[model samples]
Target: MTTYKRMVLASRPKGVVSPQNFRLEEVQAPALKDGEVLIRNHYLSLDPYMRMRMEDVKSYAAPQAIGETMIGGTVGEVVESKNPKYAVGDKVQGMLGWSEMGVSDGVMLRKLDTTHVPLSAYLGSVGMPGMTAWYGLTQIMQPKEGETIVVSAASGAVGSVVGQLAKLRGCRAVGIAGGKEKCDYVVNELGFDACVDYKAGNLVDDLARATPNGIDAVFENVGGTIFDECVARMNPFGRIALCGLIAGYDGEPMALNNVRNILTMRLTMRGFIVSEHMDLWPQGLKELGTLVATGKLKFRESVAQGLESAPEAFIGMLKGKNFGKQLVKLV
Candidate 1:
């Protein structure tokens, strides 16, 4: 029997997540029973939302159980299968957690066509992150052409896509990123109209300069003060797609001082979980896949090698240490 490495949640995080919260163990690969498929994961997605799952608290999804394999999105090749729907050597994507190999009964496993898009891209641009960007922008923050749209965490996986999609729709896309390098990339590389460097200690003035006409729509990822600043500059009847609030993910209090702007500006804010809207996945993924395939969309990745690197990589992602999409190369 072959052995595979897997990371399991060792404990619930009390504050900032530490390396001690995870335990890595080598386990034997199980035999594939009838209607089952065995996968060797190539890439593991480390996202911000995973931090919320590390705590034992009530939320949209259940907290990751201690002593279980850490929950994550994965893209890999099917090496063995008894299921008629899946063939050996098929590229597939699934919520297979942080493991070198996984067994699946095909409940939510999706076959991938990697001829145009790389297999790893399935975990980033054309996968859940891409769907998140699509749903939040098209479904919630429905901005029209010639409008100004601001995206917080603009250099991240979802935010990068949001800005790109906004531009494609003829909207003026402005990005809010942490540092100079990321801000430059958001503007020069991703084609965003302008990028505000929040770490430059002039967030309010910088954002104001970037959006001279005031923000007409917002794709908010970071909450707290960043959100308040955006709210303060929102145009009347502007829409906001409330995604992840990563600023408060470490149990920090998320106090918004601009709550009055929602009423004063008559802004429409909708908090959304992309997974809850499965009916729209086909439409969203189709458009994203086509855009990526034709080179109309662009993305970047920051990959950490090996399964053992998952814990540190995940921690780094939460701190905004990694650029673009953060992934663990399990192969």
Candidate 2:
């Protein structure tokens, strides 16, 4: 039997991820059965959620076991198929690991048409990331016209979409990012009303000046220091959509000091996962798709070359090194 190369978790990570924590291994892929297809991975999305999976802790999602293939979503091409629903040369989105190729049951794989958009779109704005923003805004945060919205990690895969959606709905959008360059991108290119540089050392004061009336809705991505400030500044009856906490997911818990704000403001906070709200995905996708197709939506991706660079790309993403969606191109 012929085998393919894959990146697997060698051991659980402690603080920050290093290349030594992961290993490349060759594993034999079994023959496809009925309702199964062989896929050639084209692109792999590296998200902040993956970092949480690297640790040994209880979370909403299950932790990836040591010595198993690292869990991630992928956009790939079907090279062979035993499933009647799928044919050769079809593009798909599936729960495939970081590998050259693999056979999977079509249950988790959704057929994709690259003709309408780029093949990588399934791993980006036209797919999960887009759906995440849609659900977080419409279902979770519930922003009203003239309300102010604040989002952390504002230049990232999920946060960027959150900011633009707020702007589209006639609300003032404020973004919090790591540096001046990223802050500029969200404000100038993505049309955010204001942005704060978290590294500039004035997150709390900047947020104060940017949102004078107080934040009505917050799309939270970095859930440590930024969250503490956001909770402190929330308006009465404010809505907060808690997404991934990249800063805290890396193992350093930020000290919090906002008990008075939560109690006095009476904020309603909710945490959501994109997959849990899959029932509304069709509607969300259709809406976001129209925006992308009409050019009202814009996306940026930092793509790594091949499977050999997956580890480095994964590491860089935890440190917020890439711009927009971080992807690994296998072919």
Candidate 3:
């Protein structure tokens, strides 16, 4: 095909993201250069971090400019190649954005081994989310046996793995999710010790009951009230791995009322971007891939059918409408 479809940022979101913020358009696919590979993207990953990129405000990464293809992770099969490093029919992963097709010079793409893990998994459990969980739990939280470990957004792609890893390490895994279904999934499906539903309107009390021993380590995903409640229950010298703050991603500035807990409890909270620590990826992916390949690690996905569904699917994810990893199947 000479042309392909792509979703671009039509406008920066003011509060909550909506369909109007994205514009899907067809564009001419340029001919491959001497070192380029043409990939027909099969899946596109929708993540919370993409919300932060929608704003013009300063962040670790540049804001997605209006008219630029919406940034994302993708897994696809190379359909044509001019580069020796990659060949046609090689499945690969890259930051290819929300497009049906993308061209790469082999700098960003990495060939995948779909024999062990499914291709879609490269966008979820055995991919960035898994790496995030591993890095945060191992490099930062470092929970010891019998310690109470709490994770917010417990049913999400990252939080699910965090709690599972915590459980494997002999720590008591307590999850905090939005609803009863998600909480139940975290506890039963993912083997978390307990899961508290924040939307039940008894968050503080529910969390207290779940982490009766007091939180010793926390894998924080949703910030704002959920984070504040978790911090209020932290044990002295507890470690917190701050991954994402999806609760306040729309436009609201996050204000933690329990900031005093940090001082009183002497918490060690560290915020990290998974990509920054590339040194740990090989180790993290190896362990995660093994767990997944062996059936020790479990993950779920909520997929949208086509590329045109990306904007709506993304908005749903931001509102906690998706159960696990949200993905768009393009081909």
Candidate 4:
């Protein structure tokens, strides 16, 4: 094929993201140069972090350039190669953005062993999201056995892994998700000790009843009222790992009314970007991959068929529409 379809940021969102913000275009494929590999992307990862990158505001990483291919993680098979490091038919994962086909110079691509773990899983449980959970829970929270830990957005890709890992570490894992079905999946399927449904309009009361011992550690994903309520129940010397703030992703104000709890309870809170800590990927991915391969770590995916469905799917995810890890199936 001489041309391929790709999506680019057409316009930045003023508040909430809309379909108009993205423009799909067909572009001519360029010839591969030396040390470059060509890949036909099989899956595209739609993550909350991509929303943060859309704004031209100060952040840990530079904003996604307007008119550039939308930023995303992808897993695909190499179809053509000019690089000695990557052979054709080798499966690889890379930051290839939102495109059906991408060319990599072998620098950003990593080969995957899909013998046990599915190819798409490398984008979720055994990939970036998994590493994010591992770093936040193991490195930041550092919960002790018998301690109670609560994770917001508890049914999401990152939060689900956090709660499961906490359970494995002998901590009581309580989840906070949006709906009854999600809450049930968190508790029954993922095996969290309890899951509080935030959409039930009883976040404050429900969270209190779930954590009667008070929370020893918090894996915070949705920051806003959920985070504030969690903070209010934190035990003394609690540790918080701030991963994402999906509640306020659309320029909404995130005001925490329980700031005093952090001081009085002596809570330790740390915000992290998994990409910033490349040194830990080997160790984190190794453990995560093993657990997933052995069925000790379970995960789910909400797949949006075809690339054209990306914009709507992404908007839905921002509004808590996805069940688990949101992904786009591309071929």
Best by lDDT: 4
Per-residue lDDT for 173-263 in model 2, tens only?
9999989999999999999999999999988899999999999999888877788898888889999898877777767855556767767
> Where does model 1 exceed 4 Å of error?
none
Per-residue lDDT tens digits for candidate 1, residues 1-331, read 9899999999888889999999999999987789999999999999999999888888999999999999999999999999999999999999999999999999899999998998988888899999999999999888899999999999999999999999999999999999999999999999999999999999999989999999999999999888999999999999999998999999999987998999999999999999999999999999999999999899999999999899999899998998999999988
* Tens-digit lDDT track of model 3 for 1-331: 5899999999998899989999999999998889999999999999999999999988999999899999999999999999999989999999999999999999988899999899999999899999999999999999999999999888999999999998899999998888889998998899999999998999989899998999999998889988998999999999999998988888788988988989999989999999999999999999999999999999999999999999999999988899999999999
A best-first ranking of the candidates according to their lDDT comes to 4, 1, 3, 2
Q: What are the TM-scores, per candidate, against the unseen true structure? A: 0.99, 0.96, 0.99, 0.99
List clashing residue pairs in candidate 1. none
Decide which is better by lDDT, 1 or 2: 1
- Judged by lDDT relative to the true structure, which candidate is superior, 2 or 3? 3
Q: Clash pairs of candidate 4?
A: none
lDDT of 3: 0.93
Instruction: Specify the poorest-scoring 10-residue window by lDDT in model 2.
Output: 253-262
* Cα-based lDDT at residue 25, candidate 2: 89
What clash pairs does model 2 have? none
Q: Any runs in candidate 3 off by more than 4 Å, and if so which?
A: none
